[model samples]
Target: MASKIFHPIFFILLIFIPLAPIGHAKRSSPSDKNSSPFNFIKKLKGCQKGNSTKDIHELKAYLEKFGYFSYENNAHAMDDDFDDTLESAIKTYQKNYNIKPSGIVDDETISKTTTPRCGVPDIANSINYMQPRDNNHESSSSNIHTVSHYSFFPRSPKWPSSKTYLTYRFISNVPTYARAPVARAFQKWYSVTQFSFEQVPTNQNSDLVIGFYRRDHRDGFPFDGPGGVLAHSFAPTNGRFHYDAEERWSVGSVPGSYDLETLALHEIGHLLGLEHSRVNEAIMFPTFSAGQVKNLHPDDIQGIRALYNQ
Candidate 1:
């Protein structure tokens, strides 16, 4: 949306270009110092101590997406110099993710940002209309637009018990390995809620639809091809879960591999209508690692149970 200097981040390929292919199949971590976007960012300067650059704009957009920055000023945040707002946002992001609160966009911070995360906003306030919007939910505080804790979109939506015995269908065309974690992800949520998910073939209509897509696959929020976002799901009753087919998705704890199960678990929370959590230990937390395995945190359980009356 701007010049080459101000194009959205990720447009820059590393000068050395040792990073893996960009796709949901994988999102590199800081450990991949030799080839990650973080490594590229770490080599730069002027992104700290109230100094900004074009990269800072990208970072600002990222922070807004994950709930660190406000949605109010999202339209005009393209400053080439870092400001107090960016510093504070970086600190909050670091604190939530357990990074040292340095207020700098260091290698670790950029690496984590590049990690696969749900394409959904940390909290919605009528900004993303890719799916249905509910405006009935009240705000916890007027000052804060979005918080990191497990929250509800507008009205704290939930599936009724009549729909408890839900059915889902995986995009039949993807590799079989994708099925393992997708199925397990549904079961994981089933263990805690009144809901029980059954898989139906794509030919038949299902309550939930799961599939892989790449770039602007027509649901409004487009996948940026590789590292920036992993997958996204619409809020409950909407029942749409989409993964970036471009990602190098893995089924298990493969180092340097993006865990489909971990991501599926997080996205399912969204399908069930739960928001991102402030608790770093919570499955609903906004950020995750390449090989992370997380069970439902109390906050996650409470949020879902509260919505479902379980």
Candidate 2:
């Protein structure tokens, strides 16, 4: 039930302003173009190329960092050719970065590959615009769950059955540090609801697949440079959770670190049919300030209870 006032409108407005002009601008001719800045990084040449015939563990490792492959080794057959794997990896990279999904190595793909992952710029400015002016709620803990006007419509469907348990899966291709916080995120919901949940390794039969990536992966919600929206999730039928690969997700009990657990908890709340909460105290608030999601408030509990009650 975190405050739902933090709508995507704020972020959309910022992106639209800068991008509108670029979309309408005339394209530069190839002949008029000078030396390309991305000409040098046209291939995966910096790292030692693994044996093309052997299983390319190193190549997989490299691609996984950018959310290309699922971390679960068994999800993909080991016998698959490294070249083919690399092709898929390249394609996902292209999709996230807004390039065409050709699955072929090209100059544009190389250029984007080398660029660092970060959220959208002007995030601070956008947050300021959307948030209240001269608000002094930081010191007051009692108002955390107070409902406000910005909440969206609750989208919960009828419960399948009281006996029908809900399941969630977090499938990550990033490193261990990135995937570790997911457990605590699930726990956030279990803390308030009567439902039982567990994290399953990515497999062919898994009900939900949570994949993380930076820019483009498979779905159309291409991640902007690190700071824009932290991540996005598909609706119920397509339960896919994708993270912006550019984020250095924090996973511990620290003050300033970005809590991966907290973020995932919020997103999963979305997955569970909850929309953004009008109450700032709820964990489902659309935007998060640093170190703000240590716990869930009563509004979140109320929403979940309403959904699960048959």
Query: Candidate 1, residues 96-185: lDDT per residue as tens digits?
Result: 566788988787776666666677775355332122235323335668653224567666677865767778887765556677677777
Clashes of 2: 20
What is the overall TM-score of model 1 with all chains considered together? 0.73
lDDT of 2 at 46: 29
**lDDT string, candidate 2, 1-310, tens digits:** 3221111111111111111111222322334223222223444442221324343444454355334555445544343345556676666555544578777556666555443322211112113211223421222366654422122222334335542344555554644554545655665666666545555555644444666674566575566433335666644445666666544445544333346667777766656655554354567655554344446666566666666652
What lDDT score is found at residue 244 in candidate 2? 64
Q: Please identify model 1 stretches exceeding 4 Å from their true place.
A: 1-46, 70-76, 98-102, 106-111, 126-149
Q: What is the TM-score of each predicted model, taking all chains together?
A: 0.73, 0.48
Q: Pick the candidate with the highest TM-score.
A: 1
